[model samples]
Target chain A: MKVTDEILNRFIDGELNSEELKEFKDELNNSRDVQTQLRALQAASVSFKNIKEDSPAVDFTSKLMLSLHKKFKSRRRDSIFIASVASIFVVISLLIIVYILAQIISAAGPNSSFQPGLQVADIFEKIAQTFVSKFSSSSVSIVGTIISFGVIVSGYFYFDFLKSTRSN
Target chain B: MIKLTDSEIIESIKRGNQSDYSILVDRYKNKAYSLLKRMLKNNMEAEEVLQDSFLKAFQALSNFKGEAKFSTWFYRIVYNTALTRLSTKKRKIEMEMSSIDDYEFLKSGFDIHSNEKEDTAKMVNELINRLPEKNAAVVSMFYLDEMSCEEISNVMNLNVTNIKVLLYRSRNILRDMIVQNNLVEELR
Candidate 1:
């Protein structure tokens, strides 16, 4: 039976069965070619084994750590900024709701005591009138455009922050 | 200080000891860099990819279930990062090479043209670097990392049988080169 390089590879890898091992050993005892092949394979294996690991740049770890630190700091700032913005939005929303409710209550009951110098309802009417009378369609459209741009920029930063946090 | 296990260091990093990650980095950087150097065949690109790999691993550390060894998981990042860089450079790495044609091509194509006598180790190293990217990665993972074929299969996303085939074919090619160049005596 011919002992091929495949068989020798299996032998080196300890993939040979007991029967195959016995047969291979028998062949090994008789054949110089098999011995030569085995030696060559072993030498090749040794050469690989002798390979030294290549180091990265000397500052690799420090540079990575510095970047990580920067990411952490930036994420912290983003978190704080998002939290502040959200808090302001919630507070403003609640104040507006309370102002509207107070206006409704005052309008419904003449005896209601909550009264600001400028009534919220009148302010809303005046603002609506101003938009309708003084603001041109193009001006209103410009305002809408500005609002849309603001929303888009905020959304972009929010998603970008989320991505940064998740990746970090 | 006692050397912390990779798992222990990872735990510390998870606990907010971000600096502790440097321990794992120091432990793996050289070996993983070696793997990248072989796969990318350019030291600068390899180093850049290695840094990116470490960043990716750190980012994904929370998802590490520790089901596999850390080295296996980390090397997968290293391998994939180098692969992406290679793709970006439009360098196609052959994943599957026909055994007979690959063996014959490697055997005939390996020519060490330098007339100056070279060390066997350096000669063998150059031969290894000349291997196809994926094949070189397998050899590096197997010998440099001392990883088993199973672990290599995990990192390379190939079946264990395929990994063995790559390993065997690579070794045979290296064996032929060694024998042809009369380097076995030096190894002996």
Candidate 2:
């Protein structure tokens, strides 16, 4: 019978029945190759079993926990900071867009007489109205836009971080 | 007073009991560190990989389905982490070796009468380290960590049969190396 890997592994593991063991021993006695293979297996096992276990340096756990905590905290803080910065940018952009639109509307209005007193009053009223209306609408739009973009960008960064981290 | 299982510890971590994660870390860190040390053969790299593995395990703990033992799952993370480090280092060394001769060079000085057993063990360890990365991993997991073939299979994502075959092949290779080095005499 051909000495199959399954049989050899079982022999190595000492998992054969008494009769199977007898047959295997007889086969081993007849086959030089089988005897050499068995000896090699035994020697390898002996060498492997002799490997020594080395302990990690003292304070490994404490330092690891501290570092993990700091990493988690930094990641959380970075995400929050990015979101806040993005929100601020969106708010500023909306405010600038609103201020320009108000200026364009006021300059295009029918009250274009440039008499000093009336011009000053009209300009004041226009400035106040623009501030009030634009502040309200821009606040809503800026907050909405900021939230959406912030979420998308933060999500992308988070996933990228996770992917890179996993591979490392 | 209630006892906690690995699953329970994981659940507690998911519920925001972040401190409970230390239990999980404490449980697997040493084993992970040991495996990395053998795989990378560098203490600093092993420690970094160990920390990275634990951080990963903690982050992904919620997704753990209890299909495998927690140690097995954690080992997979550690194994992958160490393999990446080894591969990167291997690439750097391969580039450097292009300029050097292919043949082995003698050390500046040799101790002619080193203790035979100690020399043998050192030679054996070197040969084990020289095995294909996968085989080295299998031998390290099996022999160094005292893990069973099934556990190795889980960590390695291989079938148990494949693990058995790999283990057999690796043992044969190691034996051949030992005999070639004259560490052990061939049986007559």
Candidate 3:
């Protein structure tokens, strides 16, 4: 039998057939390389097998679970915080736009005659009438646009939810 | 309490039973911790990285395809995490493979070694820890975890043949350590 390192290793580990094993044993007595390899293998395996397994610290599980819980909770909190910030931003932008438009309207004083004795109610009624008439003409298109945007956003979220579920 | 397969538990975890993840943590923490400690060679660092690996695994659990065994998959993550952590310290490790050829053979094969050699035997695992990363990992997995080379190949992402070769080289290195340290009692 032609003995090689891998073959010799297998023989030491009892992996060879009986016929080959005998041939290797016969060769071992004469070959320094084979004998040396076998001794080395034996020493390594015998020592390694004797070492004990180590268990983690007693608080290992609790510590891991606590960390995981904190991570999950923190992620939830981050998403909520982002959503809150976004809504606050939208509300603030709307308030700023209303303020600007109100300033523009006030800058362009009511085109009606300022009868010095005109009641405050009469001026309020006039402003309300002009505001509705100005926007009422395109209300249908504006409502259509808002409804289309709502449908698209909802559809996008629904599809996203579907994709996540399907992947899971 | 019915025993649930890992994949089944994984399915439930994906279905929103997040707490079920604790079962996996409980099951694999020892193994994961042990391997990490072997790789990192530090208990506190191993504990921290172990948590990171588990947390990352849980976060990415949705992507698990259930094709490989869960342990294999999870261990891959742990291995990669250690690999990343090791990269930071890789430059600092000065390997002393200087006297490899000086290894002596046991006289006419192994002799009547006794409990007296227990100290050197004890240093065997420590010697293993000092091997190069891939070699050390293969040795730890094969010996400590009692895993097959095939399973280790999956975890380490190396082919079985290559792993075996590395394992053999690692054994020789270990053998040389045992000899070079003059731990063996005698040549007879």
Candidate 4:
């Protein structure tokens, strides 16, 4: 049987089955041409292996470790940065909601000077008076304030929950 | 007392144990460098690619689920990094040489000689390096690293059959090159 290039390739790549392997080995032993082909392929593979393995750079492990350290540190720093930014955003959003609620509450309280006897001083006074009057007369503002506060607190808690879950 | 696994080392690094990454890098550095050196055919570029590969691996360590062996994942990174660098360099050279005439002129100056092989082993390297980069990669991965065709398929993003065919063809190419160059006699 002739050893085609395909068979020789399969033999070289170790893709041969038991039967094929036996045949290949028999051929290699019996035929000088097959033996020559196998030897050349094996030698070429060995040379490539040696060139790669014998690179001159010394302390490659240490250098790689140094670069890995820098990379890990930078990645960690980036994660921390992103986490801090997200936390700041949450904090800022909470603060803004809280501040808006505080202003609404101060304007809506019973002692709000926007009652019938109170003076409407200027545009600021008129705006404040209008805001107080709306809140005092209607239950909608109170409900809205409660829901908004609930939403803000829930958002904060939810963000914290998400952060903890992600960390885990 | 504990012998840390590669995944464990990666987890430690992800959890901010920067020092533990040294073990991971130390474990894979030489192999990665060797892969890059064979792929790029230049020491400086190979070293740079090796560093970049390790750095990329460290950065993406969190995503590594250990589905494959750590070395396989590391080798994939090294292979990609080296290929990317080579392509970029090739593109830059092409850009610098505008016309076909310019490219031919540049190519004439570039001496792509097979190194003098002192022995069978050296002749093998010469032939492997003389192969096209893709074929060389397949040959190296199959022969030098001893990776399974399936694993190489995953690493190279080719079908298993494709990798098998590539390995087959690449070995034949090397065999032919060696015979043509009269290196088989040298091997004997």
On DockQ, the leading prediction is: 1
DockQ for model 1? 0.73
**Largest TM-score belongs to which candidate?**
1
After superposition of all CA atoms, the RMSD between model 3 and the true structure is 13.0
TM-score of each: 0.83, 0.64, 0.66, 0.65
- Arranged by DockQ with the best first, the candidates are 1, 2, 3, 4
Q: How many backbone clashes does candidate 2 have?
A: 0
Best by lDDT: 1
Q: Grade the docking of candidate 2.
A: acceptable
| Interface Cα root-mean-square deviation for all models | 0.9, 3.5, 3.3, 3.2
| lDDT of each residue in A7-26, candidate 1, tens digit only | 99999889999999999999
For model 3 chain B, the run of ten residues with the poorest summed lDDT: B99-108
Error of 4 at B163 (Å): 2.6
Model 3 lDDT per residue over A29-119, tens place: 8888777767766777777666566667888778777777766776676677679869999999998667656645564577854443343
Candidate 2 residue-wise lDDT, B1-188, digit = tens: 76588998988888888888877777666766667766676778888888888888878887899988887888898888877776777753653353212213211122314545557676656655555556667888888778898899988889988888767776666665555555555321
Write the residue-wise lDDT of candidate 1 on B34-69 in tens digits: 999988888999888988898899999999989999
**Native-contact fraction for each model?**
0.90, 0.52, 0.52, 0.45
Order of candidate numbers by TM-score, starting with the best: 1, 3, 4, 2
State the lDDT of candidate 3 residue by residue for B1-188, as single tens digits: 88888999999999999889888988888877878877787888888888889888998999999988898899899999988887776622533232223333212233324434555655665665555567767777787778888999999988999888877776776666556555543321
lDDT of candidate 2? 0.72
Better of 2 and 4 by lDDT: 2
> How far out, in Å, is residue B188 in model 2?
16
